[model samples]
Target chain A: MRFTILFSISLLLTGSRGFAQQRFVLEQSSISFHSDGVIEDIAATNTNVSSIFDASKGEIAYLLNMKDFQFPKKLMQVHFNEKYVESEKYPRASFEGKIVGFDPAVEGLQQVNAVGRMTIHGVTKDVQFPGTVERKGGMLAMKANFILKLQDYAIKVPQIVWQNIAQQVEVTVDFNYRAQ
Target chain B: MMRRILPFVFLLPLLAHAQGDLLDELNKTKPGTDYTIATFKGTRLVNGHTIETKQAGTLEFIFAHRFGPLDGGVYEMFGLDEAFVRLGLDYGITDNLSVSIGRNSADKIMDSYVKYKALSQRSGQKSFPFTLTALGGVAYSISPRRDDEPEGFETVDRLAYTGQLLLARKFSPRLSLQLMPTFIHKNAVSKTVERNDHVALGVGGRLKLTRSVALTTEYYYRLDPPDNDVLEAQTLSPRYNSLGFGIDIETGGHVFQLVLTNTTSLTERTFITQTQGDFFDGKIHLGFNVTRTFQLKKQERR
Candidate 1:
């Protein structure tokens, strides 16, 4: 009886292998900035991502890219296509990090702290993010908000009109990515 | 007469194309052909507005063709319909520079000037795509005074110069705004300590109602404040410059404007000298502009 019970426990543990890995993606997103007596609104898509759990190393990795950012205006649309932003030269901003103290063995929802390095506008900064992780039907969800400075990315503000513009800007991100 | 024969010559080609229904085809395309200027059509108020008071006052009628540039029609009776008609085109030679010649009947004066667009619009920025425009003008008055006329009379033949800075921003697809800060210098100095060189501040705005319609209003304030010294012999009060307002409706290529203003002079110099419009008294002028464009084609050797 003891031998049969031990064999059944091994089958249950092996059956759950590779099922704890969770992936989440950003579906649709928008960002707004109001500063220095002016307002600038931006919309983003397909450049944000995060992984709650890593099956191979037992580590969660979070990632994002910025080159996919797009600002909308009929006239500006044409300018962005030909001038500045130069989507061809610089394409994306990305972040990669691991969620600390996450347990793959847990089946329900788990909250954890994720630390990662995010690269944007050709500048990378080490970032710490708070995230909630869930393991249900083999899926994971994550979200975070942070601040970024233009100077950090080598973005220059000209002196002629610097007094009217701001140097620092805030960025917020929320994503629900599904695994293929 | 070239004018009499020109009609038949131009009509012959149209007659052949329409197979004899020339009038019908002309009517069908008339509206579209009239209102096709590149930039937006500004609001031109025709209901006795300030700009129309002075046959030479420069109202916001540039959007509509004003009596075909350079022809200061008889006593501006043509301008009783459009008081101040400033032609914005060219003068002999210049780059990015445009010149204007206008006449104001209310003040009995003639005026002319030039303007240049200094800075073009840039990316990642809002507001006027261009900056730094300079204008210098001269005004000549027709009526000085008669020796036998009444005493205590004030007739100033003032030559004036005006400089204005125009800043515009397209905030959105449906809304655009412009601010015009101007300074006027009159040749005949004001005797009163309060009215120096007729220094005044002016601002104009345009609100687009649709692709072809907009509401426009312009205000001018005598910053120096009026002096208490009044000429006892004059019949009407001598007010500096007054306010002007109007609505512009564009159909096809033609623009129709209804205006209300207390100032009759269209040019800055004339407007400074004579602005007799009073909205309270219902003394506004109403007018419309019908612009016909002719596309001259280069003839090729047969």
Candidate 2:
């Protein structure tokens, strides 16, 4: 009976330690999107995205204000918020998901995939994308590049400006996270 | 059984808080207040200025035209034969400050002005209700000579100065209103018959019809009308209040404004004090303004 109790205690301790969630916060990050239209090429970047990372459970969450996106041309920024995003009605875009194939003990650099629901313009969809995650010393950095189809999220572009904006946009996300 | 139950107890807390903790971290920081943007389609509502100003390091090129009164009859081709043009360049030094220089063909006049945005309207945590801008402008007549000059128009006497306060409110995405309290000073005027100073109140409104189109209107009423003797001696058509109607069309980086107004002159110096037409009468003029904006500096998101 003593041996059974010892085994139970040891299993419970190991399970608790493995399942414990370790919180990490975004230190510095950049999220950018590029649209290669037939007539014009447009791009915007955002640095004010709020995010939290869980290294043990390999989970991630991101929340960003649509108006936070910055463009080289101020008019484009206004059009993005007013006509495209309708930011007044839906001011936020968010993503919450899990990162697979990330092993903290293995450290170094590893290839991983993030599976999550990305919400934009008040529309949400399931997305799975590949990324590179590197753990160096005390910080973990993630870099990802993916192509997003606007129609998939119901972000429609009027026919008049069809040549001004592309139907598919390439989005790049880079983030450095540190333990909280 | 004890080992299986013990492991579940430890794992339950981790699974339950997975979504909750991340959500809490995000809710901790809400976005700052949202400032109102694109209150009016263009910088000019109709004949007068609007609360709109160019963003920092942006340059705008304006080409405008005003034709003679529609009542000029067929010989004038319904006024299209007589077209006065104005070319202007406006530059934004900052998001809230801008300066412009322009020359109008009507009186061979040169105009230079500065505008400052004092307050912005915002909604959210600490909100503001209205937008305000202060504008000061000076115009000079470069004409060699005119039969009816304000004292033969000497170098200094050709100058006129104007000051205005633009107050505007966007009641909704579709409706916006503005009120302008204007003051003008002329370097010289007919002795006692015409005062050197004039005061007027202008009211304007814009109704957005679509994402790319809007309707705008403005009227300026003079508080002190010059005496009849000043008008008759100057050989001028009786001075009347300025009234205008405009349609704004926006595409890509260009803004086109179609105007119908009783005020023929484009410069505030003459339009505010020496308007010749009456909207009630058939003295309306057709005009148009087209502006294109270019970004001079890169504003990258950091």
Best by DockQ: 2
Estimate every model's Cα lDDT from 0 to 1.
0.45, 0.85
User: Can you write out model 2's per-residue Cα lDDT over B1-302, one digit (the tens) per residue?
Assistant: 87657656655644566445574568677658889888897888777789888899999998888899899899998898988888998888999999999999988999998999999989988799999999999998887576655544568988999999999998988899999999999987766567899999999999989877899999998997886666777775588899999999988789999999998788788888888888889899999999999999978556
What is the C-alpha lDDT profile of model 1 across A1-180, one tens digit per residue?
Answer: 544554555455444443433323334333333234244433333332322334334344333323323332222222232223333234344555566756756766677776767665566788776766565544555555555666786655433332433566566555554543
- Candidate 2 Cα misplacement greater than 4 A, ranges: A1-19, A159-162, B1-21, B144-153, B227-235
For this target, which candidate reaches the highest TM-score against the unseen true structure?
2
Over the stretch A89-169, how does candidate 2's per-residue lDDT look in tens digits?
788888889889998767788999999989988999999999988987668899999999888877777757446898889
* TM-score, every prediction: 0.41, 0.88
Tens digit per residue, CA lDDT, model 1, B145-173: 46643455445434567776655444443
Docking class of 2: acceptable
lDDT of model 2 at position A90? 85
Give chain A TM for each model in order.
0.59, 0.87
